[model samples]
Target: MTNSAKPRARAADKRRRLATEAARVLHEQGVERTTLADIARAADVPVGNVYYYFKTKDELVLAALSEHSAHLDELTGRLDQLPDPHDRLKALIEAWISQRETAARYGCPTGTLAVELDKRADGILDTEAGTAIRRLLQWAEEQFRALGLPDPDDLALTLVSGYQGMSLLTNALRDPDIMTRQGAHLLRWLDSLKDTDPAA
Candidate 1:
């Protein structure tokens, strides 16, 4: 409501929009093929304005990485709301199922981006580049721990790996239904773990 606060809010909104668009573009085009102009066009901001917010392509990409991390956090935070850890874990697989089409088209947003960054010699890969999936894995680990599973760490690895692996296969085969089937399979596995006691 205040005059100064209004401008600050507007600036923050503008930057968030820019970063989100950049992330979408990078997801569609991969990191090396995408340009600031491509991102600016997607965001409906001028290329010159992009330079005003980010001095280099790498800076913009890092902003996109932040955008992805924020998205991952929001997703896991929602999973945290479920009353049952088994439900929460199953919901994680559901989230991936919901985006199966997009994965079939562009791959898993977090996984593909992390893979691209890892393969790149560009320094953006060094700076919080793969944290989105890493953070997701950590979140899953927490959920497994909450479930009192004997092998929380190993279970978390299975969950995250299944997601990434299915994402890759779905994308490679252009078969969105692969994720649907994978979700069903993971749900059954989670059910089998519901009664496990970590201390036993």
Candidate 2:
């Protein structure tokens, strides 16, 4: 590649790395507590150089949100690879439950961010924060619909709500086992719904 194009590519790579680190920091320490310096430090980028990519912390937060949204889409695509809808939903639960330790320490990344952003005076970031949860909910709804459920939307909401609620409690109580138990319960619930026919 030309030298000019090389610099642009390197800059883009730095921005992507910074966005990833920002997402991790934001998940661990709410957006209010996360600073541009923290992200720069985590990403190993020069603090001053962060301004070249993001003028404000909010802009970085938006980039982090976009990064998370892309991750959610990728996860949905992975789950879709399972042939059985029930298996796909259970895999989703397992995927989140596997992060029980993190959830116990900092709470569900997406859920915590949504709650924090919703409380902020800035409405735009709050809406963007909700994108992750919305995507999961939409994916869950599609899985439920594929299972022949009549009220797939309600089931989807319930699944998402249950997962988020358990994560919240686990974090507040600092108990990773709470998520483990909840994951088992969710799997059982999926089993109960497996044979239900939408036509009936």
Candidate 3:
């Protein structure tokens, strides 16, 4: 490869590794505790290499949030294949619980980042994490729409906010039981919407 190609090759490699390291650190240590040095350490690169890819800590945090968003998108795709709205909703909640459990095993970065980011006024909080949350909310709204719920967007936001709050509580409790206890209430709410058209 030419010298020019070498730089491109290195750039691609750094981007790939940085993304991977960001996910790991975000999942393991949360955003506040996650540093470029920490990501570099996880990626086995010099700290300077991190700076080479990300000019600011927020950039890396955004990257981590993007990675997490991509992950949830992938899950959404799987749930999309189910034929029944009820089944899809069940699967969605189950997946959420599973995700939380895995995060717990990895130390719950989503919960950590949400709390830390909530305190800041940065735009990336919306561009990064908020966008991902909206994607899921939109999907849930679609599910409600399919079930003949009126105001699917409102209902979906309710579900989304409820889950976000529930996940925070679950993280605080460090127990999956919270999900088990609350899952039925959410399911009933979704089910209730199916009995009539939105206008009805």
lDDT for every model?
A: 0.85, 0.90, 0.75
Clash pairs (backbone) in predicted model 2: none
| The 10-residue segment with the lowest total lDDT in model 1 | 191-200
Whole-model lDDT for model 3 versus the true structure?
A: 0.75
Q: Which ten residues in a row have the lowest lDDT in candidate 2?
A: 191-200
lDDT of 3 by residue, 1-200 (tens): 99899989988888878888887787677777777888988888899877888898888888888887888789888988999876788788777766667533443345456666888876557456666776788888888788776688998888877777677677677776776666666777766766665444
lDDT-best of 2 and 3: 2
How badly does each model clash, as a count of residue pairs? 0, 0, 1
Q: Candidate 1 or 3, higher lDDT?
A: 1
**What's the TM-score of each model vs. the native?**
0.92, 0.96, 0.81
Whole-model lDDT, candidate 2? 0.90
Please report the candidate that would top lDDT against the real structure.
Answer: 2
